[model samples]
Target chain A: MKAIVPIKRVVDPYAKVKPTADGAGLDSGGAKFEINPFDEIAVEEAVRQKEAGRFTEVVVVSVGKGECEEQLRKALAIGADRAVLLETQEPLDSPAVAKVLSEFVAAEAPHVVLMGKQATDDDNNQAGQMLAAILDWPQATFAAKTDFAADKATVVRETDSGEETLELPYPCLVTTDLRLNEPRYIALPGIIKARSKPLEKRPLASVPAPKSSVVSFAPAPARPPGRKVGSVAELAQAIKDRGVF
Target chain B: MSLLVICFDPSELSQVAGFGASFGTYDVLLLTGEAGNAGASKIHVANLVEVPPADNIGKSVASVAANYTHVAAVSSMRAKDLMARVAGINQSAMITDVVKVFSETEFERPMVAGSVLARVKAESTPIVMTFRPAGFDKTVPGPNGSVESISISDTGRVKRVSTSARQGGRPDLSQAKFVVSGGRPLKDAATFEQVIGGFADKFGAAVGATRAAVDSGIAPNDLQVGQTGKVVAPDLYIAAGISGSTQHMAGIKDSKLIVAINKDGDAPIFDQADLGIVGDLYEVLPELEKALS
Candidate 1:
């Protein structure tokens, strides 16, 4: 069995996200970049499965500019056997991201494809499910618990009342949720070893680009300070009185 | 929904309010399947959709869609079978999950996330775009667009296989009453165990989480309450190390009472907390549990 994990380079969550001058996107300048934390969990989960001998090879794929290769290396250091970087410089939104990913996954033909539920930079959280749809495969979102056995996955999901489980066949797409597991850190030795492992770079010439471009992309405006009341009970009363409740 | 936007987090709804009200041109009604931390708003009177006691994703959407004429239903860009099922319901779907809008006569939604967008002319009045929902000027207080009852049809586009018999596992943290949340300050799981464990045990609360913790693999996504995850209105929401992010706040905005137990005085959780304990969860939680006991 094989597992493929898709990762993205996103704005580091710790940094303050200021709006771009144009108000269309995040001004990531001078901010640090990191492997999308949610995607790290997906990578970790796949690597764990491989380490347990529950699966065979692990392929780490990153879709972004060449900078994403560094993210792939982090996956490699964590435990991925190899890396593939889909090269492009443009800001590819969620649907476009999924389209490129679907094309790549089809060629790899792994038993399962996993990704973070959503990339923090974009926060759209739609690509994984869209990829599943494009592949005409089963998809699961917000999975709290997942077990792999007999080439099938049993995933516990969120509902309004309580948790429910879904049994999906292999070759489906799954996005990892935050509660799934804690990711392992890369030891210094593993980072050194990751360099020796193969890292493949592919151009978007073969990758599909969405025909439409963003008419606009803007940052969300800051909310006014909630009339900072002295106490929570007072806050609740204010909210109720203001009729925002 | 008359016009839908996928809101996994409560702050996303606020963002929607900002987008719709500030940049929007239409008098649209915002309907959240569940209103997040902000709680119920008179501006957007959100309604809860009923699902069959045991059903797959298809049945859940179908049951909800049955209640309306459903000119179009917006789903998350990641909703695999949302449009296919809507098509199966015999509603001509202009399916795109990317950022999209209404073009007066036609509804334009992004076909592939935010890649290339497509325009679907609504030969039928209510056209559905799965991903991008149009921004509203403001949440108008009015009737539910006079939604009439409708029945499911056999469109035969594609059908999802049912997995109800086996009852696969999925977490419903969105519904939990007591959530023990963590943040960047929590450092590692070993340290978090004492604080979160004590809080969960004392209040009998399920753990709540933020996107920051969830992404780091310290917390599971289902346990995360934010704009992109589940929205929980628990009885007691306790924040151990969380610094309230606007996005993360959406999930727990509906929580009945929020307690911030942190070492930092400036943590955003204090701004919204009913009870702000400006101290360490490491010190406060054990003491809190002991006091309760």
Candidate 2:
């Protein structure tokens, strides 16, 4: 089985995001950039399938500017067999990203596609599910555990209360939760070896684009800091007192 | 106004998609937060009514049971409310988190900490189902839109009680610009404070810790930066000793510039770093601090 793990290049989480000049977007001046954290877990899950000997190849894919090729290469270092760069210099919406990813997925026809529950930048976790809709397949999101076998995968998603399990045939989409597994780091020697691994770059023109228009781009409103009680008991009491759990 | 909406179990797993798929048809309204932030389509409705859990249908029915066009909500945790709405009753309604309501059909929702997915396909035309949180294509707005509140509340159940709120401290280390994050490489809590405190003070940045560093029982979860903890989008993110697991990556994906300082140059953090120093963080930090000074 082959896998495609979608990733994003967003402002590093450690950077302080000030409101953009118009109070609509995040200020990006002199901020750090990194792969969406959830994407990292997706990449790890795909790699684990290979290590478990369940699959043969894993490809980490990203859609962004030319710089994303470097990000793709980093995924390669982590054990992804190959990488695809959907070259787009400007930031893209979920539909746009899904469109290009669907085009690539159709061409590749990988048995499974894995993605982070949501990208950290926008916190919109629908890209994987949206791509699944475009592809017309089953989707298991926020998966805590995924067991892949011959042409089929059984996944368990951890819920706030407990868990939900689903058994679906292959060619499905799965978005992973943070607790899925502690993603392993690539060794120094592995990094040197990864330099020799294969990396593929594709342009936006090469694939069809979504028939959509971005009406605006803005940062999410600042959540006035949530209050913090002394302890969980206090937190619980506060929740009770407010009657707004 | 030309609009068609659905309500479903706000806590059902399919809420997001059901809402997303139906969003293009008309003006979409999502109910969220205290639940998930449900209706966030770029071109949809946004009237987050402060209601009780799974009481939307009950409230909507009791308030406007006569205006029975359609109502949509979930049937997972709020199964009782859905029953009351479809039970052919009017005046007597219980408060519910009704996601959407069109006609007869209903939807349900299931959510983890924050991710929302809903299950739709309850009935036919005049569909009433709840809009699942994060269910639709949200980053992209549809067309020009506006918000109009339909004050459909009369049989209010819960009354406003006294509120006790506290002022929060700084946004954690992940949210800090010049974060001084520590990993297992820091031997103990005391050593950690020695290094992290100076860095935090020097740069006026917040302090953060890796899971490994936190497990030493030194720091708290508030300072832990990883997948399960706070997601930080800082200006300059630094990895002192963190190996950069995807779990840890959850907290720092939005940083602008990442600087990795570790004994292993091959750590996953380096891949995300703009500048990776290939030396011991113990040796590298003070030297870098001296240079910054």
Candidate 3:
């Protein structure tokens, strides 16, 4: 069995971002780029599953410009067997990205597709579900723990209510959550070995145009500065003043 | 344009109804539980008493989504999952965590956490979206809408083994009018609940925790309030012992009034706070609880 993981390149999670002057999109504020933190967790989970002998091979896939190959290589260093990059310059929204991934999944026919629940950039939390829908496959999202049998996978998902356990048959999709596992730091030797891994780059196949686009972006409204109170009674009065008490 | 508002949580029906009513005459797909007066023209309910897994319900929604120009739900983990599938099956446009609706084709949502609000336009039909209920007004209870039974097939491919529901009866963190959250300084689970939770009980405010607190196992994952956790916009947010990481700030930026209580007066949280108290939360929270009482 083979497991496929799709990762995304995003602004570093810790970086502060702002709207560009024209208000069309965000400025990364000179923040470094990295594999989206959630996607990295997905990569780590897929690699761990391979190590456990549940799958014979693990392949990391990414979509976008050539720069994405850097992230793909990082996934390789983290223990993915190989990497595939569908190079494209056209900006894609969730629907279009899902369409592209569904096509790839159909062709690859991996038993399981693992990915992040959401990308920190858009934070749409949709691709895996959308891909499952297009593929007509079952999906378990926000997965905190996953146990795979020969033909099925039981996943514990982190939901708003609490944990929910779902059992899904083979050829399914599971989106990783933060608590799934702690990703290992890539050592110098691992990085050196990544250079030798097969990094395949192919032209992005034709897909439908994005159905939705960002029209403009504006900075979030700022909160008024606050004053410090001297005592607990004063704090209680402040809370009372807000009508919250 | 006609709208079909999907709701799985009966408790949020009024908020969902209020949002849908803003777009015009709307119908509802009540997936589970009981709903009170929601003001929807039609309340289409499924057979189940409890909400089914997302994939099962998603197929049911996709099967019927084409009948309306807009399909929406109050944003939640499960709803977002199902709606994405609906969007995929229909090959339609979708926007999640939407904060504003300009028309059937236009909407506003936050990205990069809540630091930026992006106005988005849907160039396709049956715009599938999830609205942040916190940003909208709850509709006043009206007469119960007409009910219609909707058939939902259990795909059986995905089986729900169980659900460990969170401690109930407290207002949901996302919908609470006031929130009291703590960070790692609160320490272990017992102390977290006793201090932060105790203080919150004074005002009926929901208790929240920073990711560090959740990661350290001091708090439950559901109580995590940050970029990757639950977003809150309460009228008053008291953040205790939190230095305010950027991700945590992103989640609470929408809050109406922020108050920070920490020993470190220069903590980043104070930069965003509307009021602050530079003191130990262990000492301050107990005193504040007493004062509020």
Highest-lDDT candidate: 3
CAPRI class assigned to model 1:
incorrect
- Backbone N/Cα/C clashes per model: 44, 97, 1
Task: Write one digit per residue (lDDT tens) for candidate 3, span A121-211.
Answer: 8888888888999998999999999998897899999998789999999899999988899899997788888999999999976657889
Write one digit per residue (lDDT tens) for candidate 2, span A121-211. 5454546655765675566666768889895788766432234555666688888876677777766777677888878777776443322
How far in Å is the alpha carbon of B15 misplaced in model 3? 0.4
Error of 2 at A105 (Å): 0.9
| Candidates 2 and 3, the one with greater lDDT | 3
Higher-DockQ candidate among 1 and 3? 3
For residues B101-123, write the lDDT of model 2, one tens digit per residue: 33233333222121221222322
Over B58-79, each residue of candidate 1 has an lDDT whose tens digit, in order, gives 4444445444333232343223
Q: Which stretches of candidate 2 lie over 4 Å from their true place?
A: A187-189, A206-245, B1-5, B10-293
The residue-level lDDT of candidate 3 at B196 comes to 84
The candidate, 1 or 2, that scores higher on DockQ is 1
Best by DockQ: 3
Candidate 3: misplaced stretches above 4 Å?
Answer: none
Ordered by DockQ, highest first, the candidates read 3, 1, 2
Q: What is the DockQ of candidate 3?
A: 0.83
Per-prediction TM-score to the true structure, in the order listed: 0.63, 0.49, 0.97
